[model samples]
Target: MIVEDSAVVRHLLAHLVSRDPRLELAAAVASAEEALAEIERVRPDVISMDIRLPGLDGLEATRRIMAEHPTPIVVIADAVEERGLRISMNALRAGALTVVEKPLGPGREGWEAVAEAICTQLFIMSQVPVIRQRGIGGMGAGPGRAASARAGVPPFSRPSMVGIAASTGGPPAIARVLGALPADFAAPILLVQHMGASFMEGFAAWLDGLVAPRVLIARDGMRPQPGQVHVAPGNRHLSLTPAGLLRVTDTPPVGGQRPAADVLFDSMARALGPRAMGILLTGMGEDGARGLVAINSAGGITLAEDETTAIVYGMPAAAVRLGGVSASLPLDGIGPRLLRAIGGTLEATGGQ
Candidate 1:
């Protein structure tokens, strides 16, 4: 279903959806109310949600939809508008799968890429299974706990940094894990989330609002402090200097990811060695699998989100197959388990 107030954009989106052989337009409505009303009847496998809508904005509509009838929703948002971007991120927090920049029109520059990304995200996200969530900012929907342990592997005594990577269903998953941390979390964190360059700042802003750590776009030469998160800037690979300061570089995209999780994990392997903790979360590809192995080779702690909780099990499963992970855990268990690891109390969970 397509929900938008502008008739032009609505028609444009409808055209885009109709032209794609992989997608079928269930319904096109001018308001979220109409979407809510017709959802059960039309029963789209996926929905392209407009963040700016006439009455019942996309955020609230997403919350209600997830609560009542669970379905994968991809948010279509204006990339540059502050209010619109905030709403877009909040819509993700409300259980929308991912956000894509909306195509203004065929004449607009870069309109082709935006349009393609929308259809692509829709097609890919539709395959993901989403469940009914209660209330807004849906939290604690973990599918219980599962852990894998390798025996005789000793835990770390003092970790200096945390590295995390995610793609696909990353935004909300990142929010859930980061929000669970205490304000005084002992280590600084480095995050690499695969998203469009235009949305990075707003993504960081939204993360800062939800997480205990103070989140900021990573900057070159800046030192990360405890209880803080440094997210790789768009189109830049984030790493750490031997001096423990941040390094944002434009050398080249590793495996086609500028802010590749591999870059961060590899840097941690070099800079912090055994004191680094590397986590690979839900993503569409294998960008972080080798990097997690690099950390494992350095004797650092490594974790991958288990299949029980990952929206897309690609990245984590890749790491597991490559023998890089030390533990595989459910979404809800990551925070407490990580805390225990940092607190020097966690036992081995085999993934080796």
Candidate 2:
């Protein structure tokens, strides 16, 4: 299903969907109101949503749909407009699966590539299994508290730095973990999230507002500071030098992902060794699995988000299957576990 206000874009998407025999055009509506009304009848496996609409905007529509009837949604956003990028991030936070930039003019150069990319994204998103919204309170302080209470003697030493990698349903998960940490957290944090180029600035800005620590896009030659979070920019791979300074490279995508989790995790394992910590969160594919193994082999603490809380279990599952995870935890528990790890209070019990 496609929910777009522009008739031309709607028709274009419909035609594109028709061309792919694997996809079915359940419905295409012009406004959010119309989409809300028609979605129940269509029961689409996935939806391509536009940010701007006549009645309710795409973000709100996405929130409502996820609350009432959970389904994977991909935001088709205008790449040039800053507001479009901002709303697209909000849509992801509201439970939409991913965002794709709207193709430029249909007849312009590179149109075929853009069209093919959109089709590919749609097909991939349709296969993802979506869960119902459990509300904000359900996400905070439950199993994590129980686990923390049972912790015995601490095994892992305090880490000098922390490296995290996520994709797909990562925005909210990142926000949840960061929000739980204090402003005075002692370890410098590095993050790599797979997102479109147009959305990077908006995502960093949005994340800054949500977390206590300073959140900024990573820059070459910058040294990460404690209590601050550095996010890899789009189209660049973020890594660390042996001197512990940040390095952004134009290296080719690893496992088809620029700013791949493997790059950052491998760098941390080599640079900080036992002094580093690696976290693999909700995402698609096995990009970070080998890096997590590297971290484990280096005697560093490696964690993967538990399958129950992960929006997509692909990345973490790969790490767990490879025997890379030192501990597998729920979303809310991860921050608390990290806090305990840094505070030297967590037990030595191996992977759960």
Candidate 3:
């Protein structure tokens, strides 16, 4: 299904979908109202949504659709406009699977390639199974149970930094995890979220306002302060040196992702060892699985979001299969478990 206001772009998107052998056009509508009217009737496997619409913008539309029908949605956003990018990020928070650069019509240069990429992304996203908002299930594991002799890790390990890897349904999950942390959470977070290059700047800016900690695009040679979050810049690998400074590298893409999660995790393993903590959240692939193993081998704490709460369990499942995780937890349990592994910081700071 396609929900777009522009007739020209809508027609082109429809054409793009029809032409792709891997995809099929379910419906095409000019407004969110039209989309809502048609969604239940058509029952599309996926939806291509426009962030900006005549009435009832994509963010609200996403929330309603996820609540009512629970279908996968991919937001197509204008990369040139900061506000559109912001709305796109908000749409992700509202339950859209992912956001992509809006394609101009075929008259524009490089339109064909961009359109192909968009279609491929749409098809790949369509395969992700969606569910009605369950509001963070499976909190069975708590801070008390975080320490496990069965998992082969110490009961307490003071981590100096945290590295996270996420993709597909990541934005909102990351938001929930970070928002659950206290004001003085005390770890510099290095995050690698798979997204289009154009969305990275706006993603960081939007996240900074939503979470207590400071969030910014990672920079080379920068030292991360406590409670600061550094997101890997687009098209670059974010790694840390043994000296404890961030490095944004131009090295070739690892596992087809420029700012691969493995790069960040591997670096953390080498630099911080037992003092490093890694979290593999909801995502569609195995990008961060090896990195988690690297950290586990170095005696660091590795946590993975269990399949029970993960939007998609690919990354976390991969880690579990590779023997990388010290504890497999639900989304609601991760923040508290991290705090627990810190040993005494939360009690000292008067935090829950």
Candidate 4:
């Protein structure tokens, strides 16, 4: 299923989805109201939603679906801006799972690769349990909500900053963890994800909607602050100094990426030491392994996302193998675990 106001885009997306043997078009609609009807009637396996629509916008529709039907949604939007970006980001926050910009065609932007990416995200998010948090009051119950209230985890406090890394299935995974955090979260989050340059700006803009913290692409020498997220640009390596300054470089790619997790992890180890908490989530490589080892050795907390929920399980699994991961946890537990880890409590989850 695809929801877009443009008839041409609807046709293009339908054709692209049909090309995949693993998927079939359930329906295509131009309005959110019509989309809701089609979704209930068809019970689609997945939905590719646009931020703009004829009547009810895509983001509002996403909120309604999540609050009601709770199905998997993947956002396909134009570039991020005030309203458009807000709509797309809100969709993710409302449990849309992932956000990707529209391809560069007249209808669907004509980018075949973008269509493939959307399909891949939908397929992957579908397999993961759609554990939507009803409200903060639901914490400490159910699998998804219980993870949020696990005892002995430390509450977030004043930490100079936080550093995180992910790859492959990173965007949605990162959003899930970040969305759970409170708006007043008292530390800046530095992020590294192996993604293309074409999408980095949009990615940051998209993230700003899902979390309370402001999200921006990192600028060299920027000082870390609470309630903000700095993302490593596609062609840059991001690091931190002992004094808490961001270091973004155009250095050669390490571990198959310019914004390699290893570089960020190692830098955090030297800079923040025990004050740091490193999180390794779903992905396709071992870039963060050694750096996590350094983090753990320096008394910082390290966490790996558990395989059962990961789209690829490569990076977090690799960090675990390196004997650096202090705890291995399911994706939903990551935010609460991080809060605990940063607060100086590290009870075993028996997860890995």
All candidates: TM-score? 0.90, 0.92, 0.92, 0.71
List where candidate 1 sits over 4 angstroms from the true fold. 134-154, 344-352
Q: What digit string (tens of lDDT, one per residue) describes model 2 on residues 1-352?
A: 8999999899989998999887889999999899889888899999999998878999999989999989999999987677777788778878998888787657887788778878888898899898887765476544532223445323766688899999879998898888877776777899999887767878898888888888999999999987789999988999999999999999899999998999999999999998889999999999999999998889898888887788899999899889898878888888887877776222232211
Q: Model 1: per-residue lDDT, tens digit, 1-352? A: 9988899999999999999999998899999999999999999999989998888999999999998999999999988999999999888767888898888899889888888989999999999888887543444535543345442334664576899999988888788788778766777889999988999999999889887778999899998877788999988999988899999999888987888999999999999999999999898889999999999989999989988778789999999899898888777667776777766222232211
As a TM-score, model 2 comes out at: 0.92
What range of 10 consecutive residues in model 4 has the weakest lDDT sum?
343-352
Q: Candidate 4, overall lDDT?
A: 0.74
Candidate 1 has what TM-score? 0.90
Per residue, candidate 3 scores C-alpha lDDT tens digits across 248-291 of 99899998888999999999999998888999999988999999
The pairs that clash in candidate 2 are none
Write down the lDDT that model 1 would get: 0.85
Candidate 3 structure, TM-score to reference: 0.92
Question: Looking at candidate 3, what is the lDDT of residue 259?
Answer: 94
Q: How many residue pairs clash in each candidate?
A: 5, 0, 0, 5
Instruction: For each candidate in the order shown, give its overall lDDT on alpha carbons.
Output: 0.85, 0.86, 0.85, 0.74
